[model samples]
Target chain A: MRPRLFTPGPTQIPERVRVAMSNPMMHHRGSEFKEILAGVIDDLHYFFQTEGDVFVLTSSGTGAMEACVVNLLSRDEKVLTVSGGKFGERWGELCVAYGANTHIHNVPWGDAVNPDDIKKFLRENSDTRAVFITHSETSTGVASDVETIAGIVHNNSDALLVVDSITSAGVLPFKMDEWGIDVAVTGSQKGLMAPPGLSVVAMSQRAWERVGSSNMPKFYFDFKKEKVALAKTATAWTPGITLLMGLRESLSMIRAEGLENMWANYARLAHATRQGALALGLELFAHSPSDSLTAIKVPESIDGIKFVNRMREKYGITVAGGQAQLKGRIFRIAHMGYYDALDMVAMASAVELTLRDFNWNFEPGAGVRAVQRIFMEDE
Target chain B: MRPRLFTPGPTQIPERVRVAMSNPMMHHRGSEFKEILAGVIDDLHYFFQTEGDVFVLTSSGTGAMEACVVNLLSRDEKVLTVSGGKFGERWGELCVAYGANTHIHNVPWGDAVNPDDIKKFLRENSDTRAVFITHSETSTGVASDVETIAGIVHNNSDALLVVDSITSAGVLPFKMDEWGIDVAVTGSQKGLMAPPGLSVVAMSQRAWERVGSSNMPKFYFDFKKEKVALAKTATAWTPGITLLMGLRESLSMIRAEGLENMWANYARLAHATRQGALALGLELFAHSPSDSLTAIKVPESIDGIKFVNRMREKYGITVAGGQAQLKGRIFRIAHMGYYDALDMVAMASAVELTLRDFNWNFEPGAGVRAVQRIFMEDE
Candidate 1:
C-alpha cells in the first residue's frame, strides 16, 4: 500500500484531481485552453473571495512571494515583515535579497504574532510600503490573525497588506476583498488539492498602483506582464497545462463542498487529531494552533526522528517533523486537503502502535479511541 | 475524441507517464522522496550526457533560462546573445532585465546563426562572459549548430557556451560533455514525454565558476542554494512531486529505447513529415530545419487560424500557428517524442483533408502517400 501523506504542504492529492491530470495536454494558445483558463480563473476568484485580479504563474509559491516583492517594492523601500515561522521568515529573506530596507518583527516560533505589534510598527514606520505576513505558518502549525492585521495596516497608512496564504487560502476562512488585503499569494499543492507547479497571486487595485511605480528587475515573474495576458484569457509564457487541468477539477471539488463547510471540516479534523495526540500524553506545540495541521511536542524519552520513521516504515504513514530549532522536539501531522476523519484516525492508530512498541508511557489504543470518539460526536 | 497536440511544447503526454502521475504525492522531505530524487538526478545526468550537475526546477523552461542568466552573470557584464526565435530571444530579455549589457546577434527568423559570425564576434568582444545560443528554435523550426558554436566560443574566449536546448535535448543528438556546452536548459513536456511543470538545467564547472562572482539579485532561483540541497538528495523548496514521478517513468522509456535510436527515429519522422508537406505543394519555412518539429508556409488562400482550427475540430489533430509577426504566414507540425510513423501520417492526412476542405491547392492523399514512402524507405 502507498503511504498516506500528512505533511503541511504537498498533501495527498484527491484521486479525482490526479485523474484530471491524465487528460492529454493541448496547445496553450488554443481556444479550448482559453475556455478552461476563463473557468479556472473565475473559480479561483470565487475561492479567494476577492474581486481583484488573480494571476496564475508557472512557479512555486515562493515565486509568487518574490513577484509580490519585485512588482510592488523598489530598492531601499521600507517594508515591515512579520516572521513567526519559516514561511514568514522567507518574506524577510526575499525583501533583503531585493535590496529592500525591511524591518522584521520577530515573533517566537510556535506562537502567533499579536496584531498590536503590527500596529505599533506601523505607527513608528508610517512610510512603510508594505506589510508582509504569512496567514498560516506551516512550520509551527500557527495561523496569524490576518483579518485584524489587515485592518491595522490599512487603517494606519497606505502600506499594502501582502499575505502569504499558501497553506491557509482554501483551508481557512480568508476573504481578501472583505479583509482589505492588497495582495494574497498561494500555490496549487496545498489546500487547493492539486499537484505542485502553479503559483497563484491575487492583487487589489491598490497593489497594482504600486506596481507602476516599482522598478525591480524581473522577467519571468513580472506581474504586470502576467496581468496583461490574463486579461485576454492567455498566459505570457506556456502555462503549466497539466497542473491547471488538475486544478480545474480540484477547484470543482472545493466548490461542491462549499468553502465554509470545508473550513469547518478542517477545524474538526485538527481538533480530533490534537485530541487524539493529547490523549496519548503528548503536549501540543502551538499556543494558537491552525486547523490546517496540528503540531505536538515529542516526549523527552522518545527519539522524534525514530518515531516519525516508525510511523512511515512500519505503518506506511508519513508525518512531518519540526524544522530547524525544534527538529527533535516537535512533530506535525497534517489533515489539510483530501483528508477526513478516518485518515486522521489511521495516523493516530499508527502513532499509538509506534509509541507503544517503543515502550513510551502511553496506553496502546488511547489515541485511536480519542480520534474515533471525536468523529462520532461530530457526526 | 480529444485533440492530439503537435505544438512544440505541452505535447501529448504518453499513457505510462500519465499513469505514473496518478501516484499519491509524498512529502518532499520524506525518505521515499529522497530516494526518488537521487534516482531522477542520476538519470537526468545520463540523459544530458554530462558529468556536471543538473538541477530540477519546478518552473517552465523560461525559468531555467532565467536561472542561467541570473546565476552566471553580474550587472553590466558583457554577453553575446544569439536570437532567432521567441525562446532564444528570452535569454537576451533576461540578461537585459538583470542589467547585463548584451550584444544581440539577430539571425533572420528562420535561419541558424553562422559559426564564423560568432567567432568574429567573440574576437571583437574579448571580455564576453557568456555566449547564449539555442539548440532547436521551436518557433522557427531552426536547429542552431550548438556543437560547432560551443567549439568556436571555447577556442576564442573565456565565455561559457549557454544553449537553450529545450526542444532538441531528447529528440536530437546532444552531448553536453562532448560538445563542451557550459549550460543546457530544457523542459519536460517536449521530447522528455512528460507533463509540463519541471524544467531541467545542467551546469558545467566553467559556469559554476562564474556563479560565485555573480551579483544578480535572486532568491527563488538561486542556483547555488539548489546545488547544496541536491547534494543531500533534496530540493531547496517543495518539488513538483507528481511530475517527478511521471518523469522517472518517462526517462526509463527513453533509456530503454536508447538515446541514439531515439534521435534516429526523430530524424526519420521529421524527414517523412517534411516530405509529406512538400508533396502537397507546401513550402518549408525554415532553411536549417529541426527534427523535433517542422514549420511550413501557409497558402495565401488559406486562413492560418481557420486552417489549424479545421484540423483540430474536424480531425482531432492540433497544429501550431505562427507567433508574434508570423501569425497568419506559417503553421507548425511536430513529430517529436512518443510519435511514430503512423502518427505522422495521420497528421499529414489531416493537413491534406483540411486544406482540401478549405478549397485550397492540394492533391488528395499526396501528402499521406509521400509520408508512407519515406517511412518504408527507412525500413
Candidate 2:
C-alpha cells in the first residue's frame, strides 16, 4: 500500500495537483507558459494579501531564505537573528556564511522567541540592518508573533523584517501588508498543497530598495534580475515548468477554498490533533504551537525513531522525526496541505497503535474518539 | 490538439514519463522515498559512465552551475571561462557574482572555443583555479570540443574542468571519466525526457576536495550537507518527489534503449534536420552544431518571430526563438527527448509550410522529401 504522507514537507499532494503536473512540458519562454505563470503569481499575491512584488524560484524554501540574506544584506552588515529551533538557527548560519555580523536571540529548543527580546536587541544595536526570524518554526511546531515583532522593528529602526513562512504561509494567517512583513518566503510542499522544488518570495517596496543597495554577490538567486524578467512574464533562466504548473493548480484550490477558510480548517485540525495527543497521554512539545504541524514529546519508554519506522512499515503512514538535537525525543505530525479530518483521525489512530506496540500506557480508541469529539464540537 | 514542444530546454516529455509523475506524494525523509532516490543515483552514475558522486538538485541547470562556482571557488579566486554563446556567458556572470577573478576566452557567437587558447591562457596564468565551458551551448546549438579542452587543462595545470551538459548529456557522447571532466552538470528536461525542475551534477574526487576548502555561502544547494543526507536517500531540504518519480521512468527508458543507441538516434535526427533545413534554403547557425538541437538562421525577408508565431498559431508547434542579441534572427528546432523520425518530419513540414507563408522560394515537398531520404538511407 502507498504510504500517506504526514511529514512537515513533501506533504500530501492532492490528485488534482498531481494530475496538473502530468501535463506535457511547455516552453518556459513561450507566451502560453507565461500566461500560466502570470496566473500563479496573481493568485499567490491574493493569497499573500500583498500588492508587493512576488517571484517564484525553482528551488526549495531554503533557497528563498538564502535569497532574503544575499539580496538584502552586504558583507559585514549586522543582522539580528532569533534561534529557537532547527530552522531558526539557519538564519545565523547563513549570516556567518555570508561574512555578516550576526547577533542571535536564542531560546530553548521547543520555545518561541519573544517579541520583547527582539525589541531589546534592536535598542542595544542600532546598526542592525535586518531582523531574521521564522514565522513558524517547523522543528518545534511553534509560531512566533511576527506582527508584534514587525511593529517593533519598524518603530525602532529602518531594518527590514524577514520571515521564513515555509510551513505557515497558507495554513496560518500571514498578511504581508497588514503584518508589516518586509519579505516573506514559502515553499510549495507545505501549506501550498503541492510537491517541492518551487519557492515563492514576496517583497515590499522597502525591501526592494534594500536589495538594490546590498553589495552581496549573487546570480542564480538574484531577485532584481528575476523581477525584471518576471515583468515580461519570463525568467532569467529555464524555470521548473512542471512544478510551476503544479503550483498553479494548488493555488487555485487555495483561492477557491478562500485563505481565511483554509486557515480556519488548519486551526481546527491542529486543535483536534492536540486533543487526540492528550487523550493518548502524550504531551505537546511547544508552549505556543503553530496550526501547520504539532510536535509531540515521545514518552520516556517510547523510541521516536522506532515509532516512526513502525508507522511506516506496518501502517504505511509517513511522519517526520525530530530534527537535529531533538532526534529520538520528539516527532512531528503535519496538518497542512491536502490534509483533512480523516487524515488527522488516521494519524491519531496510528499513534495510538504505535504507542501500545511500544508498551506505552495509552487507552485504545481514546485518541480517535477525542479527535471526533473536537470535530463535532467545532461543527 | 496537444502542442508539440521543440524548445531547447523543457523539451518534450514522454507519456510514460508524465504518467510516472502522477504517483501519489511520498515523504522525502521516508525509506520508500530513499529507495527511489538511490535507484536514480545508480542509474545516473551508469549514464555518466563514472563512479564519481552524483547529486540531484531541485532547480534548473543554472542552480547546479551556481553550486559549482560557489562550492569550488573562494573570493578573489581566478578562473578561466569560455564565452561562445548565451550559456557560456552565464559562467562568466556567475563567477563574477561570487567575486571570482575571471578571465574570458572569448569566441564569437555560433563558434566553438579553441582549446589552444585555453591552454595558452592557463600556462600564462598558473593561478587559474578552474576552467569553465559548455559542452552544448543551447542558444547557438554549438557543441564545444570539451574532450580536447579537458585534456589541455589537465596537461597544462591543476585546474578543474567544468562542463555544462544541460542540453547534451544523454544525446551527445560524454564520458566524464574518459573526457577528464571534474564537474559536469545537466538538466532533466532535455535528453532525459523528464520534465524540468531536476538538475544533476557529477563531481570527481578532485572537485570534492575543492568544495571542502571553498568558503562561498550556500544552504539549499550545499553539496556537503546534501552528500551526507543523500547517503540514506534523503535530501537536506524537501525534494521534488513527483519529478524524481518522472526521472525514474525516463531513466528506465534510457537504460532499455541503451545509451549508445540513444546517442546514435540523436545524431541521426540531427543529420535529417540539417538536411531538411538545407533543402529549404535555410542556413545552419552553429559551425559545430550540437546533435540535440538545430538552429536555423532565418532569411532577411522573413521575420524569425513571425515564422515562429505562425508555426505555433497554425500548427500548434512551439519552437524557441533566438536569445538576447540574436532575437528575430534565428529559431531553434529541438530533436531531443521523446522525439522520433515522424516527429522530425512533422516539424520539418511545419517549418516548410510556415516559410512558404512568408513567400520564401522553396519547392512544395522539398523539406519532407529530404528528411525521408535521410531516414531511408539510415535503414
Candidate 3:
C-alpha cells in the first residue's frame, strides 16, 4: 500500500502536481523558466497577501528564518522572540546564534503566546529592534495570535514584526500587507503541496530598508542579491529548479482553489481530527490549535512510539510522534495540503485500529464515526 | 520539440531518475526515507571516494561552499583564494562577506592557477588558516591541478585545502581520501546527473577539527548538526526529499556504470565537443580545459547572445553564454552528467546551424564529422 503522510511538513503531493514536475528539466536562466518564475511570484503574492516582493530561496524554512535574522538585525541589536514550542524556540535560538541581544518570552508548551505579554515586553523594552514569533507552532499544534501581536508591535514600539509562517501562511487567512507584518517566511512542502527545498520570503518595504543598514555577515542567503535577481526574473545563484517547477504547478493549484477556500478546508479537517481524537478517548494537546495539524496527548496506558510505528508499519499511515520534551507523549495528525475529508476519515479509522491493538478503551467505529459527522455537517 | 539542456547546471534529468521521483512523496522522517537516505549516503561514499564523512546539503553549490567557509574559518582569519573565473572569484567573495582576512590570487580569466604559485604563496603566508581553490572553473571551463595543490598545502603549511569540485567530482577521476584533500564541495546538478537543489560536501578529519574551534556564526548550514543527524541516517533539517529520491536513482545509475567508466564517458564527450568546436574554426577558451564543459571563444563576427538564443529558440538546444568579463565573447557547451557522445554530436550540429544562421565562415558538416570521428575512433 502507498504510505499516507500525516506528518506536519513534507505533506502528500497531488498526482497532478507530481506529473507536472516529471516533464523534461529546463534551464533555470532560460526565457521559459523566467516566465514560470514570474507566474510563481505573482501567485505567491496572492497567497502571502502581500503587495511587496517575495524571494524564493533554495533551502528549508529554517534557512529563510536565518535569512530574515541576518537581513534585518545587526549583531548586538535587541530583539524579542516568542518561545511557545519547538519552532517558536528556533527564532530565539537563531537570534542567539547571530549574537543578537535576545529576550526569549517562553510560553507554556501546548499553549499559544499571550498577545498582552508581547505588548508588555515591548512597552518595557522600547529599544527592541524586532520581534520574532511563529504563526503556527507545528510541534505543539498551536496557532498564536499573530494579527493581534502585529498590532501590538506596531502600536507599542518601532520594532519590526517578523513571523515564521511556515505552517500557517496559506493554511491560514494571513494578510501580510494589511496586517503590517515586516517579514514572513514559509516552506514549499507544507501548505503549497509541493516537495521540500524551496522557501519563500515576503519582505515589506520597511524590512527592505533595514537590510541595507544591517551589519550581519551573509552570502548564500543575502536578501539584497535575491531582490536584485528577482527584479530581472532570475536568482542570485542556482535555484532549486525542479522544486521551483513543481511549485509553479502547486501554486497554480492553490490559485485555482481560492486561498479562502483552502484555509476553510484545512479548518474543517483540523476540527474533524480533534473531534476524532476525542472520540477515541485521547486528550487534545494544544489549548489553541493550528488548522495545519492536530496534536493529541498520548494516554498513560499506551506507548506513543509503538502506536505511531504500528500506524505506519501496518497500515501505511505515517503520523509524527512529538519531538524534544514531548517525545512519547503526543502524536500529530497533519491536515495541511492535498488532504480531503476522506483522508481525515481514513486517518481516524487508522487511529481506531491502533487504539484497539494497544488495548485502549475505544469503540471500533467511534473515531471514524465522529470524523464523518464533522465532515457531513460541514458539507 | 522537447528542449535539450546543455547548460552547465540544471542539467537534463535521466528518465529513470525522474520516474523514481514521480512515485508518491514519502515522509522524510519515516523508516522508508531513512532507508533511502542510508542507501544514498553509502553510494555517495563511492562517488566521493572518501572514507571521511560526506554531508548532503539542501541548497545549491554556493550554499555548501559557504558552509565550508563558516565551519572552517573564524572572523579575521587568514585565507588564500585562487580566482580564475566567476565561480573561483565567489570563494573570495564569500570569505570577504564572512569577515575573513582573504588574499585572492587572481589568475587570467581562461588560465588555471599554477601549483607552484600556491606553494610559494603558502610559504610566504605561513599563518593561512585555509586555501580555497576551484577544481573546475565552470565560467571559464578551466581545470586547476587540485592534486598538486593538495600536496603543496600538506607539505608547506598547516592550512586546509578547500576545493570547489562542483563540476569536477563525478565527471573527473578524483579520489578525495587518496589525494589527501581537506574539504571538497560539489553540487548535484552538474556531475551527479540530477536536478538542481542539492549539494554534497566531503570533509576530511583535518577539516572537522577546524569546524568546532572556528567561531564563525552558523545555524542552518551547521556541519556539526548535520554530522550528528547523519549518523542516524537523517538530516538536521527537512532535506530536499524529492531531489534526494531522484538522486538515489541517479547515484545507482552512476554506480552501475562505474565511477571510472562515467569519468571516461564524460572525457570522451568533452573531447568530441572540443574537436567539433575546433573543426568549426572556433578557438578554445580555456588554457587547461575541464572535461565537464568546453568553452569556445565566440567569433567576433557572431553575436554570442544571439547565437545562444537561436540554439534554444529554433533548434530546442540550450547552451550557455560566457559569464562576467567574457560575456558576449565566449559560449560554453557542457559535457557534464547525463550526456553522451551522440548528445555532443547533436550539440555540434546545433552549433553548426546557429553558426550558419549568424553567417559565420565554417565548412558545412565539418563539426558533425569531427564529433562523429572522435566517437567512432573511441569505440
Candidate 4:
C-alpha cells in the first residue's frame, strides 16, 4: 500500500494538482507561460493579502530565507534573530555568514517566542535593521505571536519584520499588508498544497527601500533582478515550470474555498487532533500549538521511535519524529493543507490501533471518538 | 494542439516518466525514500561514468555551476574562465561574486574556445586555481573541446577543469574519467529526460582534495555537506521527490538504450536537422556545432522573432530564439533526449511551411527530403 503523508510538509498532494502538473512541458518565455505567470502572481497576491512584489524563486524554502538575508542587510548590520526552534536558528546562521552582527533571542524548545524578549533585545540593540522570526516553528509545532510581535517592532525601532511562514501560509491566517509585515517567505511543498522546488517571497515597499541600499554579493537569489523580470511577466532564471503549473491549480483551489474558509478548516482539524491525542493519554508538546501540525509526546510505556516506525511499517501511514534535542521523545502529526475530515478520522483510527497493538493502556476508539465529536460540532 | 517541445532544456517528457512522478509523495526521511535514493545514486554513477561522488541538488542547472565556484575556490584566488556563450559568461559572474580574481579568455559568441588560448593563458598565469569551460553552450549551439582543454590545464598547472554540460550530458559523447575532467554539471530537464528541478554534479577525487582546503562560506549549496549526505543515499535538503522519481525511470530508459546508442541517436538527429536547415537556405550559426541543438540564422528577408512565433502559434512546435545579443537574429531547434527521427521530419516540415508563408525564397520539399535521406542513410 502507498503510505499516506502526515508530516508537516509534503503532505498528500491533491489529485487535481497532480493531474495539472502531468501536462506537457512549457516554454517559460512564451505568451502562454506569461499568461500563466500573471494569473499565478495575482492569486499569490490574493492569498497573501498583499499588493506588493512577490517573486517565485525556483529553490527550496531555505533559499527564500537566504534571499531575505542577502538582499535586505549589508555587512555588519545589526539584526535580531528569534531562535526558538530549528528553522528560527537558520536565520542567525544565514545572517552570520553574510557578516551581520546577529543577536539571537533564545526561546526554550517546545515553546513560542515571547514578544517582550524581542522588545528587550531591540531596546538594547537600537540600530537593528531586521527582526527575523518563524511564523510556525515546524520543529516544535508552535506558532509564534507574529501579529503582536509585528506591532511591537513597528512601534519601537525601524527594524523590518521578516517572517519564515513556510508551514503556516494557506493553512492558517496571514495578512501581510494589514499586519505591516515587511517580508515573508514560503515554500511550495508545505501548506501551499504543491510539490517541493519553488520558494516564494513577498516584500513590502518598506523592504524594497532597504533592498535599494543593500550591497550583498548575490546572483541567483537577487530579489532586485527577479522583481524586474517579474514586472515583465518573466523570471530572472529558468523556473520550475511544472511546479509553477501545479501551484496555479493549488492556488485556484485555495481561492475557490477562500483563505478564511481554509484557515477555519485547518483550525477544526487541529482542534480535533489535539483532543484525540489527549483522550488517548498522550501529551501535547507545544504550549502555543499551531494549526499546521501537532507535536505529541509518546505514551509513558511505549517507545517514541518504535511507535513511529510501527505506524509506518504496519499501517502504511507516515508521521514525523522530533529533530535535534527532541528526538525519540515526541512525534508530530500534521493536519495541514490538502487534508479533509475523513483524513482526520482515518489518522485518529491509525493512532488508536497502533497504540493498542503496542499493548498500551488506553480505551479503544477513544481518539476516533474525539475526532468524531469535534467534526460533528463543526458540521 | 499541444505544442511539441524542441527547445534545449525542458524537452518532451515520456509518459512512463510522467506516470512514475504522478505517484503519491514519499516521506524524504523514510526507508522507502532511502531505497529510491540508493537506486538513483547507483544509476547516476552509471550515467556520469564516474567512480567519484555525485550530488543531486534541487535547483536549476545554474545552482550546480554556482556550487562549483563557492565550494572549490577561496576568496581572491586566480581562475581562468572561457567565455564563449551565455552560460560560459555565468562562470566568470559566479567566480567574481565569490571574490575570485577571474580572467576571461574571450571567445566571440557563436564560436567555441580553442584549447591553445587556454594553454597560453595558463602559461602566463601559473597560479590559476581552476579553468572553467562549457561542454555544450546551449545559447550558441557550440561545444568546446573539453578533453583537449583538460589535458592542457592538467599538463600546464594544477588547475581543475570544470564544465557546464547542461545540454550535452546524455546527448553528446562525454568521458569524464578518460578526459581527466575534475567537475561536470548537468540538469535533469535536458539530456536526462526529466523535469527542470534537479542538478547533478560529478566530482573527481582530485577535486575533493582541493575542496578540503577551500574556505568559501556556503550552507545549502555546500558540496561537502551534500557529499556527506550522498554517501548515505540522501540529500541535505528536501529534494524534488517527484522529479527524482521521474529521473529514476528516465535514467533506466537511458541505460536500457545504452549511452553510446543515445549519443549516436542525437548525432543522427542533429545531422539531419542541420542539413534540412541548409536546404531551407538557412545559415548554420555555430562553427563547432554541438549535437544537442542546431542554431540557424533567419533568412535574410524574414524576421526571426516573427518566424519563431509562427512556428509556435500555427504549427504546434516550440523552438528557442537567441539569448543576449542575438535575440532576433537566430532560432534554435533542439534534437536532444526523447526526440525521434519523425520529430525532426515534422519540425523540418514546419520550418519549410512557415518560411513559405512569409514569402521567403525556398525550394519546396527540399528540407523534408534532406531529413528523409539522412534518416535512411543512418538506418
Q: Which predicted model would earn the best lDDT?
A: 3
What's the TM-score of each model vs. the native? Answer: 0.98, 0.98, 0.99, 0.99
Kindly give the stretch of ten consecutive residues in candidate 1 chain B with the minimal lDDT sum: B1-10
Sequence-dependent TM-score of model 1: 0.98
Score candidate 4 by lDDT.
0.89
The DockQ for candidate 4, computed on C-alphas, is 0.73
- Tens-digit lDDT track of model 4 for B254-308: 9899999999999999999999999878899999999999999987687888999
Largest TM-score belongs to which candidate? 3
For candidate 4, write residues A148-224 as lDDT tens digits: 99999998889999999999988879999999999999999988888888999999999999999997777888888
Per-residue lDDT for B160-279 in model 2, tens only? 999999998998998999888999999988888898888999999999999999988777788999899777777777777888999998998899999999999999999999999999
lDDT of 3 by residue, B1-379 (tens): 6688899887777998888777888888777899889988899988889989998999999999999999999999999999999999999999999999999999999999999999999899999999999999999999999888999999999999999999999988898988989999999898898888999999999999999899999999999999999988899999999889999999999999999999999999998889999998999999999999999999998888888888889999998998989998998888887888788888899999989999999899999999999989976
Look at candidate 4 and tell me the lDDT of residue B89: 94
TM-score of predicted structure 2, chain A: 0.99
Quote the lDDT for A300 in model 1.
93
